[model samples]
Target: MRRYGPAVLLLLTGAAILRVALFTELYLRYVQAGLRPYLVGSGFLLVLLGVAAAAVGRREREPHGEHDGHHGPRIAWLLALPALALLLFPPPALGSYSAAREAEQRAAQGIGSFPALPAGDPQALTLAEFSSRAVYDSGRSLTGRTVRLTGFVTRDDDGTWYVTRLLVSCCAADATTSKVEIREADAPPADAWVTVTGIWHPKGRLGTDGAWPPVLDAASVRRVAQPANPYERR
Candidate 1:
């Protein structure tokens, strides 16, 4: 067993990767969709290498040199534990706990006119888009449009609640929060996925610190299943 430790570790790690990237949508929790193929390829290679290494180890005679009892450091086996756990039980996507801990940081965009929203009673919009238009659109494109936004719930220390979503340029490690203050309705449970339909409830002037977070006067809050890809592409 000691002689094959490296093979076992590689197999476990590859299996864990395949469990999320090949067999399920769980990989979306940590990485962008574009990375799936790379992950799948890497995992496949790892599994092949592990199998080859194990076959080589089996053919070797027992060593009797000074390192006869040593098969690398025993402590290195601990690295396999995480891979085993991930294979058995993958973790959920980042939620309210992560959102709450992040400070508000919007990318700087000049206040400008946005294209007219499509004709509809309620337009479905990403949380980031809604936030951008609400805070920086000089044309006030959202003035009369009823919009539907979906995100998990998060709350502030003052009891202010927000409908929040994370935006990621590449993966969860680089995630940033995009949120809107929900008003005229009670907040759903923290981390609960919800679709909020509302009109813009403007506060402060556009492009100012006071206008941050954006505001929505919700007409309805409906519970929804969490999306497969929880992080919006930045």
Candidate 2:
């Protein structure tokens, strides 16, 4: 019975991760939405591993998790911490703090050759795509086109403001941000959710970072509620 305790706990923990990721918004903090299947698979695998271990241990009648006197069971118990944390508290999405800590890298690598925008008055785009266009397009595709972007607000010390979004490679731990510096608009409070419609201004460079995405000349800024999915999938 004692041998099965940890295994049961582990199985429950795995199930919890799967449930929260699937039925709730908690998964976005760690992975892109496209990874839902993989996360669920991983959670199921963990549960299976734990159940198999318990079954084998029961058949062999070996307690202490092994013949050896090592602290293997104790170490195994530590694996439950992530699940416990998830259940007790909601994981936070990457925000300005995470963005500020990382170096800025917003150069338009290949967006210069991007095909023409879809037929629309103001094309809607993810912050990453917009950043790429701003830095790489050089005013050809975006010369007069009004673009719409949605992101939380971030501020620079020099009275500059940015509309920002995080792009996650795998999780918040490895998140990179996309930002567009805004001009001629009142600086919204930090972390405010807003949609900005503006024309691209090739002249406004964001920072000392080598990847200088274009800035925006804001025509209107509309504050909105924070989105359910906070980060863009990379």
Question: Which number leads on lDDT?
Answer: 1
RMSD of each: 1.6, 4.2
Candidate 1: residue 8 Cα off by (Å): 0.9
Q: What's the TM-score of every candidate structure?
A: 0.95, 0.76
Which parts of model 2 are misplaced by more than 4 Å? Answer: 1-5, 51-82, 107-113, 204-213
lDDT of 1 by residue, 1-234 (tens): 667888988898899899899999999999999999999999999899999989988987775554665477778778788888978988889998888788889998999999999998799999999999999999999998999999999988788899999999999999999999999999888999999999999899899999998999999999999999999988
Q: Write the per-residue lDDT of candidate 2 for residues 134-208, one digit (tens) a residue.
A: 666644677788999999998888988899898877777777878888999998898888999999877644333
Q: Count the backbone clashes (under 3 Å) in each candidate.
A: 0, 1
Q: For model 2, state the Cα shift of residue 100 in Å.
A: 0.9
Candidate 1: list runs displaced more than 4 Å.
63-69, 73-75
